[model samples]
Target: MDTLEKEDLARYNRQIILPELGITGQEKLKGAKVLVIGAGGLGCPALQYLVGAGVGFIGIVEDDVVELSNLHRQVLYGIADIGRSKALAASEKLSLLNPLIQIISYQQRLVPENAEMLFSGYDLVLDGSDNFETRFLVNDTCVLLNMPFVFGAVFRFDGQVSVFNYEGGPVYRDVFPEAPSEDQRPNCEDSGVLGMLPGVIGSYMAAEAIKMITGIGTPLSGRLLVIDLLDNSSQVFMIAGANPDLKKDKEKSGTEEAYAINLEQFKRLSDLHAQRVCVIDVREVYEFEELPTLALNIPLYELLTAQLPLDKILVFICQSGSRSRMAVQVLKGHYKGEMYSLGTLLFK
Candidate 1:
């Protein structure tokens, strides 16, 4: 680590004066490398604080571009940045905020193929993604890499924060064994989130990151912090033991490589191999009734416990891809037939 220069001392003097955070803590903050997963609501505030705190190296991974709707909460970008790549815009603003630190921008979506390689470069990850697929992927990758991450989620007037996969701590899987079905939990677009909710939640996430880096405070490793800005009420809940079955499933899926089929491939397979293939909708009965597809209905929870005939090729479909992926894990070895997850193709 390089010595703190006169400018650094002057810039960080307020924090340096604290008994908990002196020159040593300041140096730790300056040497840390952190990666943020989104450039939207929560990511905006988290990035602001992380840069303001002088984190030495920061990486932003965002595939989206700035839009008019995002201007309300994504405080980092302006009208001039509209239609520009979010990662590039965020990196440019953060660079202007702290010229001494290094900022790297990845203007591509974080996918399973590229996740491990990108996460390997950063010391810690901060996830602010809005969807379950990305969140679960981030969690699984972090668990595989043995890296710690600060997780934050905002829904309407409520938000939750926690630290996962740090020093034998509980991971995101420990807290959320399986993602809720699509209709159960709507996104910000559908449910609507207060503009300031992300700011509050994101600040907490940034504070946790700093705490993890400097070792000054107790991190939210075994506990989850839930706050409701609507009523200004807060509670901290202790996370219980993780699901051993889920852990086993994750490990098995990693080894066997769960097969995925897109819409076109699924269509061709259905047309060509109709005699051998059986499409199973793993969503709830209500969801199946609403969508009314030709596939048979088998709720994912029941599929996990019930035995099914494995005589034909099985393809699982759900609202998004997360449940189908979980369903694939449940039926991997029990069913000898070829298995595939429709993933997000059901929506398409």
Candidate 2:
């Protein structure tokens, strides 16, 4: 698979003839190892292009099954694929599209436990996952491994595509620090997409992946490309990476990694009320009124000036955990005591 065969030379002659991509670029694609998460709307089209382009090896991770509702956007599957595993079905179709490439299907969910191991072997990752949790997991795992991943997401009539953690560029966390509350997050099942939206976005994702693999053109590393087919408009916005100095200080101090704890952990911490543990709700006053009395109201905007409980274990909470995560980042070097952002359980 390292070198293109005679059949590959003819099959890819169209692309290989391009001045930018000659035999060298085509060979690069043949040697690339890509892993795609999900086989749904975005994944379907992206996988098709990558497979057709003769990417040497591709791995598909999908735990879901094909459904009638998925037919509109998940173009890889057919009516007969309903109830069949998306990973297996997509792999079969993609293999037929290009027998020259190797495709592996993993019929399992991508969780923290398996994400690092699954992503380690691939040179690049294309995220077609729909959920915020999976998206964040993909970002975190990629960041930890120093791997590059192409991110594509579609909602309603809008779509977004970007390459994160590429060559020390801005990562997903630099753009979106935390996931929105479940109430605010809606899927295609809750709010329908334009049927063709994923197709367009997925194609863009594949293009970015190929560009990165073959060193063809610029990849959207620090820029987010937003597409709105409704108005026939597209925009690319430059995103700034998070402060590296603060991260360096934290690591240099040998402090534990900062992260949000789930609902169960938050509950266990609540029992330590008499042990100098303080919960601070960083939401605005109006939103904080609905929260339980156990948490003290200290809006995020006032956190820098307000002071007290320096020796206490500080736990921050907010409506969706976004502001809370920011709060912890704000106080990273200043707070020496134990601190954490409570995951979005209080608002749930």
Candidate 3:
């Protein structure tokens, strides 16, 4: 409450005047601590509005670097940031926008082990993450910690938003009990998304987070909001809590380290005999026109719905390896299958 100085009031004048979010509510916002996972398309707007609105402490957890392709949707970055770390770039931009706020950027990936511990520190966690593995891990960990998190996801022209693990509310595991197997899931890199879609969805997430922090109007707990940008159609549905497994998943990640590969390790693996490992291509049909040696096209969107024979060791493949890395997570969601990704394997 004491943190709201004259500068803060001047900066957030518009929002502070709202009946629901007056000086007192804005004070609550100033006192709140929020963590946003993934600093890409969705994270850009979510973090922007939250920072511009004057949240005192904001934490960004991302393990990605900027590239030429990401500039389309990730508004916080630019051509000058072609090779900089995403979390750093995002924080730097946020700092320029509002120096009164605190921004902590962790330039590392989130895994099952670290996710839970991080969730405990923040008042709310907004998942702007793209992959299913991190999504599931966030849901499970937050559910265990009883944290309030705003969830937003986008694909092509469609997007979905929900609030999970809020006080006295249902968690995401309750809504999505299992990950969409191989054929059912798709990633943004392979599916193609409208740049503004994340802006639309992410802004909603920021609004939800602000409400949760300020105790404003009802949030999206126990309800799902689906938006289609193409037709400007929106639908709201009630999601009942029926999955007992969501409650049964009581495990906690107590400093357990998650495994990840760096550029060198990724290269070393390719030197091995390619035939020994089966490569699963998650790119769509048309993208496969220029096929590579020993590559199978699964096209990310078709995962979870497609049945895999479970015949051999599978190495998921996608452009730049981001989508396939996410695919491995989704596959791990439904089945205990052995899988890995050849991140950007084609370049070398």
Candidate 4:
């Protein structure tokens, strides 16, 4: 650990004085490398505090450009930053805030192809991405890399924060095994999040990151903190049963390239009577009746144990695209025919 310089002591005097986080903890923060996913609402606030606290190496992964509308909640950018890349803009501002720290900006989306490579370089990850696909990808990548991450999400008046993949604790998959269907899951654009919601949740996320890095306080590893700012009510739910499958190596798991089909493509396939396409709804039994499409109901929990037909093309469907993706993972090597996940599919 590098000794705190005269300038470092002055800059971090307030936090350095805390007995729980004295010189040793401050030094840990100075040596820690944290990668924050997304530079929007949640990422903005997280970046501010993490940098402000003197995290040594911070990386920003975002492909979005600042827009006029993003100014409301994305606190890192200003009027002059509109049309600029979010990753670059955030890195520039964070560099100015903490000149002593190193900031690496990747102005690209966090796709499955690049996730593993990017994650290998960081000690911890902070997920502030708005979409479930990215969230799942981050969770899986972290689990694969044996890295812990702070997860935060804000929807309207409600926000949630959790720590996952920490010391064999429960992960995002243990809580939300599947994502809510497209129509059921609304984005900030459609539903509109309160401007202050992300700030509150992002700050909590930053706190979790610091705790994980410094080993000072108990981190929310197996619990989900749900906060309703509207009523100021908060609840902590203990998540049970971390999925053992997530711990499997990606190459050995055979899920590196699972096939996916959209609703339109599914409809076209159904219309063609040539192929034996079997659509399977992997949601719970109670959710089976609510689906608009005709399909066999095989809950995701029972998928691996159930003897599925191997001759037919299997198409998995769930309320949101999450369960279907899990189903694809379960049936990857066992099934001989082509498989598909109706990920992020919205049925009219």
Question: Model 4 misses residue 159 by how many Å?
Answer: 0.2
The C-alpha stretches of model 1 lying farther than 4 A from their native spots are 242-348
For every candidate in turn, the CA RMSD to the true structure comes to: 11.1, 9.6, 12.9, 10.9
Tell me how far the alpha carbon of residue 171 in candidate 4 is from the true structure, in angstroms, after superposition. Answer: 1.1
Error of 3 at 237 (Å): 0.9
| lDDT (tens digit, per residue) of candidate 2 on 299-343 | 664565578488788888776666677677667676788888874
In candidate 3, position 171 carries an lDDT of: 80
After TM-score superposition, the amount by which residue 80's alpha carbon in candidate 4 deviates from its true location, in angstroms, is 0.7
- Which residue pairs does candidate 4 place in steric collision? 180-320, 181-320
How many clashing pairs in candidate 3?
18
- Alpha-carbon lDDT of model 4: 0.84
Off by over 4 Å in 2: 242-348
Instruction: Estimate, for each residue in 149-247, the C-alpha lDDT of model 4 and write its tens digit.
Output: 999999888898999999989789876777767665656788798998999999999999999999999999877777878878776654533334443
Per-model lDDT: 0.84, 0.84, 0.78, 0.84
TM-score of each: 0.70, 0.71, 0.69, 0.71
Per-residue lDDT tens digits of candidate 3, residues 171-242?
A: 876655556555547677787999999999999999999989989999998767878898787765555332
What residue runs in model 4 are displaced by over 4 Å at the alpha carbon? 242-348
